[model samples]
Target: MRSAGKPRYASVMTDPADFSQSPPQEAAPLDEFSLIRRYFHHRQGDTVVLGPGDDGALLVPPAGQQLVMTQDTSLVDRHFPADMAPADVGYRCLAVNLSDLAAMGANPLWFLLSLTLPEVDEDWLAEFSRGMFELADQAGISLVGGDITRGPLAVSIQATGSVPPGLALRRDGARVGDQICLGGVTGAGLLGLEQWQAGQRHGPAIGHFRRPRPQWELGMALRGQASACIDISDGVLADLSHILQASGGLGACLDEAALPEDPPVLAGCSADKQRALQLQGGDDYLLLFTLPAAQPVPRGCYCLGQVDAQPGIRLRQRNGAVGALTVAGWQHF
Candidate 1:
């Protein structure tokens, strides 16, 4: 499934393996408001009562529903390569924030972009807005308002969406007996990143890295089904631990062999390194949640493990021996 030029998968991974073959290039150097008006000012729908040109934009939340909001930021090199395509950067900036809304089982409505550019490059801004709006339109999201400043290249997006009152998925609602599920394959994005770092620009892994499709539809479907939910921004072990800790000391057990493995992206890697990336690699914006055993598993989702009574993550090896994790995933001190 492709929404606005980005792939949406029904299985472990979505396929649309195309990307830039060249290394990230330097940005070419623009007026800020002129750029915004030229590219960012797209039309809006009913949800956005007032669009992007005022003191503050007015939004009309659907009646009988509560608003769910989330924000995420990406910095040059820290989050993505400094010279990566501005279009990919723009798409990722909004997509990641939208993933947060998806984890909460919300239908994304509007978003605000706060961008810091070292220097305003018209070409970069055009491509960036193109990618951003492509995903936004596909998801029915509107760019309500935002700010642009001169600084290091960084993007922070604050997205707002709607979910029925009392029905929003939460990280703290998981129970002891619920099953742990993954929205898509992890580590592919990391694989993409590694390839980019190695100066290899185009491949399956880089495609996944550059353009990640958020599981918004699946999230909406999980509304009453998922006991607890979170997006995989910081990798499985770390993000899953957040659910466990939030759910009041509930632990989880993962079957090592049960995890999804994709050959094209992970081929040639040692088994140990493969497992480590799957367990600990960050930047894979997939969803992780808990569901009851009786509920039917949604298509495009994998059952990785189950919530347990104990308090920390444990991995059950193929030989049936369980071991504890000293380091689960990425940490941002």
Candidate 2:
């Protein structure tokens, strides 16, 4: 029986013995298209000429601008904890890649994701996509295309952005007397890692590690103003060293007194640990750049030091003593 404006459906219950004569029914839990629709699919944005479908995507790069691309990989227990929320993992996977584009003073446009999971978990995918797409939308980036598969938990994102020609920031323009600047403080990510490893998982440190904000706008604002730039993916000291090496083997002197320190998060930590977190720890993802001595540093950035013709990094302690840095920074190898 059917009601007005309502459709009627019939239920079919087949016996095992009669299955040989009937057509087969789908038994697989979820297909790829279904998963994509339920999770990653969203309305197209301005930059998307054609969004996620078909063999590829069409993106309209801003006219008269260069396309900048960067990719980042996150693995279970390597980039994040095994017990970390899927949402946080999703957020960081994109944040790190955005940091790369920011270092080059690019405006985010679109991204592609390649995700691998142990199995199909709808709930996890939903949460993950929520976190990832929310940030993408906030930055006006379109979800262009991607691939999903079964494997150990891992995520890789390739992000693309646009920058005006000849105005992109680089690491080789540092000059003597240029000011070394930081978009924000460091060590919060390391503090978060320490707390996670020590079984204390909820705190500001953990929050910093799980959800780092990329300084995209600040980078864009710095394009013509900054001489050399890099995002602190590794620790500040190490990443700054990269600029030094790139700029014809120059050097820098950091004023320890000016560096931001989160004492409460680092409370009860050893002095060595504090230094390591502040200097050698990685994953901060903040911007580090050099401005000409005559230029005013943009708001929300801290002046940390000055570039020098000397060939290594030196830190002037709060006690007025200079210390030689033996450890350059975080090393994967």
Candidate 3:
């Protein structure tokens, strides 16, 4: 059953447009090796002893540093729309993974992409690679090695990073009296996703949904300063509970009046709606960490509250009423 004229790794021949779902298409048969060479293969860092094309990556561990690795998968329709641009899908795949490294106070190093695609289209590959490498170049990480196989569209990225021994941020280090902090505003991510799904093409909310900036530099800077750190991929209440529960059953009392309100993208929403969005939105990849009360807070970040020895998270209202912030964020289930 050999095709005498095709290369060993070449897929069955067809114009990429012939396959149905949603996308821009190009004329070229799907060829595995050619796709890898054109898209994922690139010059790597000096420490990469061997990169793509090898069965596995060969990397040199940094002196006195511990490696941190995290993986995330995005599926079509589940994570994003099927018709979403290829470039957005590619960029988001890496950004989410990098956010994990940020939460750990680690610096970007290299990443492996396990990409599953329905078919290989030259234009799709071009845009996808452009978006992925754009961030990789900016973040100083490089593509190492991974596998690509034909299947339902999905993008899974495993990112590797490093930090000096005994300095990595974690969920368990928070303590009573530590100040709860936010890297930036939240709620825009949900707004953006709503707008995108409703067919609105351009706006701040849509932009935030498409391109979330991982708080990498800030996370790195917080090393040895913050007590615990976690990215707000889930909603604020959900992610904060993670910090609290992990820190020996600690709790926090947040100042409701202190949270930044109605960011420009959310200006049209009612106050209650805005609060729910802030507390329940997912994909706000900002870093939410706790710091000592005496430590100088970084500029552009917000001080949300203080960790407590109590058993649950609560909020202090402007009028002095206290209530529990018992709510779920995003559940993969």
Best by TM-score: 3
Per-model tally of clashing residue pairs: 0, 0, 1
| Candidate 2 C-alpha lDDT tens digits along 1-333 | 001111111012143223123324554344555677778888777778777655788877788999999998888998889888888888889999999999999999888888877766779889999988877877777788888765788898999999999999999999999999988767878888878888886877788888899989988999899999999878888899989899999998888878666467566767667777877778888899999999998887889989999888889989999977764566665
Q: What tens-digit string does per-residue lDDT give for candidate 3 at 1-333?
A: 001122322333343323332233454444555567777787688879988776788899888899999999999988877877888888888999999999999999999888776765779889998999988888899898888766788888999999999899999999899999999888988888888888887888788888889888998999999999999998898999999888889888999898777688787888888888887898989999999989878999989899999888898988999999776788898
Q: Write the per-residue lDDT of candidate 1 for residues 1-333, one digit (tens) a residue.
A: 001122121112222333222223343112344556787798787978876666678888889999998888888888878878888988888889888999999999989887777654678889999999989988989998887765677788899999998889999999988989988778887778888989998887789889888989988999999999999988899999999999998898998988766556677678887888888888888899999988877887788888999888899999999998754676666
Error of 1 at 185 (Å): 1.2
Could you tell me the lDDT of residue 37 within candidate 3? Answer: 79
The candidate 2 region of ten consecutive residues with least summed lDDT is 1-10
**Which candidate number maximizes lDDT?**
3
Which of 1 and 3 is the better model by lDDT? 3
lDDT of each: 0.81, 0.81, 0.84
Return the lDDT, model 3, position 67: 97
Distance from true location, Cα of 321 in model 2, Å: 2.1
Candidate 1 segments whose C-alpha is farther than 4 A from its true place: 1-31
After the best TM-score superposition of candidate 3, give how far the Cα of residue 49 lies from its true spot, in angstroms: 1.9
TM-score per model over all chains: 0.89, 0.89, 0.91
Which pairs clash (backbone N, Cα, C closer than 3 Å) in model 3? 192-205
